[model samples]
Target: MGEVGLRTVRDGQRVLRFQAAVIGAATSQRGSSPRWSELVVYRMVDGHYLISKIGRSTVAHQPTCLRVNHRMVPWSKAAAFGEDSVQRVPCPDCRPELGHGIAPDTMLEVTRYRAILCQTAESAAESLMGDRAALLMPQIVQTVLAQCSESDPNFSRYAEADTALPRAWENTTRTP
Candidate 1:
C-alpha cells in the first residue's frame, strides 16, 4: 500500500491531507505496477515538480525512478489551464531497466502513456483546446510504439499484449 499527501498553501496558510492505495507486484506477462506507498515528493520548486517512485517487482527487486512534470495555469480560456504544461522531463534512474526490458521499462512506458493522456485531458478541458486532444493521442501512441520498437525487436508481435494503451484505458475504466 502507498500513501499520498497533498499540501496547498495560499497566502501563507498551509493545509495537508493524506490518502492511501494498495499496490501489488508486477506480473511476468506485462510489467510491474508502481508501489503506491513508495512515492515521495522530492521537491516542488518553481513550476516544476519532481517525484521519486519505486518499481513494483523485478530481478533488481526495487529500483528508484525519478519523474518531472510541468505545471502552469493558462490565462487563455481556449487553452487547457490546469493540465501539465511541459513534456515529462526524462528519467535517468530507469535507463538500465529500459535497456534490459525489465519491469522498469513497462512502468516507464505506462508513465509516458499517462503523461500523454493527461496532456490530452488538459487540452480537452478547454472549449477551443479540445481539437488538439485528437491530434495528441495518436502522436503519443506512435511515440510509445517507436520507443518500444527501437528498444525491443519483438515489440510489434507483442503490441496487443504488452503495450496496448487503448485496452489499458478500457480496462481501467471498466466497473468492477
Candidate 2:
C-alpha cells in the first residue's frame, strides 16, 4: 500500500492505516455483533457458490479499492476455498476472489469455518487470541507482493517501497 498517484507519500501511508483504523473502529462500534461481516459470493456451477470475498460493508460497497457490482445471496450457500473441488475464476476488475466460507450443503465446510471464526474471533474477549489470530496477515501480504514482483518487478516495486513504511525503509517510487 503505497503511492496511488492520487495522493502524496504520507497520504498513501494513511491508506493502510485507514484500514487498520477502520477495523479497530468496527470492534468498538455500538450494536455491532461480535463477528459480523458482509459475505460476497459468486454463483458457481451446479447450484454451488463461492465466497468471492469478505469484509465490512464500506469495504465492499463504498471502497477506495476492491470494488464490485452484484446482487445479494444468502450466506448459507457460501463455500470455502477449494471446497467440493469447485473452481470458478472470479471477476478480475472487481476482484471479489477469495475462496473460503461456510455452506449449508456441506456441514464439514461449515464446521471448518466455524472453528476458524472461533479461534480467531470467538475469544476476542481473551485479547491474546486476537493478537495471535492475525499474525500471518502481513506475511501473507508480503508473499503476494513478492509474487507480483517476480511477475513484474517494475510495477510491483511500488508495492514494496513506494511508501515511508518505516523511518528506516526508503520510499522508492522510481524504477531503476
Please report, as a residue range, the 10-residue window in candidate 2 with the lowest summed lDDT: 16-25
Query: Residues 87-107, candidate 1, lDDT per residue (tens digit)?
Result: 222234544333332332222
Per-residue CA lDDT of candidate 2, range 1-176, in tens? 22112211121113211111001111122353222332211112222212211222211111223333333222333332223333333333443433574233222111112111112211221221123232332343333334334433332332443230232223455556
Off by over 4 Å in 1: 1-137, 158-176
Estimated TM-score per prediction? 0.16, 0.20
Clashing pairs in 2: 80-101, 81-99
Candidate 2 TM-score, true structure as reference: 0.20
